[model samples]
Target: MPKLIKDGRVVDDQWQGEILQPEQIPESPAAPVAVQLEPGQGPATIPCALSNLGLVTIFFPAFTDGRCFSYARELRESGYTGEIRATGHFIRDQLFYLQRCGFNAFQFAEEVDLDACLASLSDFSESYQAAVDQPEPLFLRR
Candidate 1:
């Protein structure tokens, strides 16, 4: 079992969802599927089954593409309260932002050092903006 950073710790990843590609999603699935959300599709365009999925993985096709961040936020707002895993070639610096957008797990590309990635989650004691983990901005508390 490969390890992934989950909620700020390295844990054994027990991911069970099948990675379904775009072309293969039209067919109904018997088992739970983890589909990737690209940069442009609206929430309405996503299959209803996906909203009910227990584990959804956001795909980062490249380092520069950032549409997945909004997708995670949308999924949470839409009431899909399952595990959201950020996978692919995202930079380590994006971990905190990823969590703020509702990603609970991160499966970095094979080249990333998991230890350093895990440490980054605790790099800062506070953030000024509102996030999923910290819904209120620091300014509001003062």
Candidate 2:
């Protein structure tokens, strides 16, 4: 099984899902479930019909596309509390930023070093702007 950096550690990924036709969703997934949504597919992609999902993995076709950041935050702010993951083409340098955007887990492409990405999560001790992880911006604390 492929390992993932979840909650800051490497763990066996149990969630599974096949790319179903636009009309199909696993009626009752056996274990934890994951749903893949492309950036700009919009938050409604995770509508009530798939509320049982344990994870939502957002696809980043390119590092330059930042829509996924907002997608994850919107899911959080809208109250879908399951794990929000960023996968594909993302770089280790953006791990902190991704986490701040409400992504609790990350599944980078196999070419990236998982260990390095895990360490990147702690590369910074603080952030200044408001984010899902820290709703209050740094200036507000002054």
Q: Give lDDT for model 2.
A: 0.77
lDDT of 2 by residue, 76-136 (tens): 8887788887878888888888999889888878566687678889878877999998899
Q: Where does model 2 exceed 4 Å of error?
A: 17-23, 26-33, 49-51
What local distance difference test score does each model get? Answer: 0.76, 0.77
Model 1 TM-score relative to the real fold? 0.82
lDDT of 1 by residue, 3-52 (tens): 88987788988875576554556656666666666667534555646644
Let me know the TM-score candidate 2 reaches against the reference structure.
0.84
TM per model?
A: 0.82, 0.84
Q: Which residue pairs collide, candidate 1?
A: none
Alpha carbon deviation, residue 68, candidate 2 (Å): 0.4
Position 25, candidate 2: lDDT: 50
Q: What is the lDDT of residue 24 in candidate 1?
A: 54
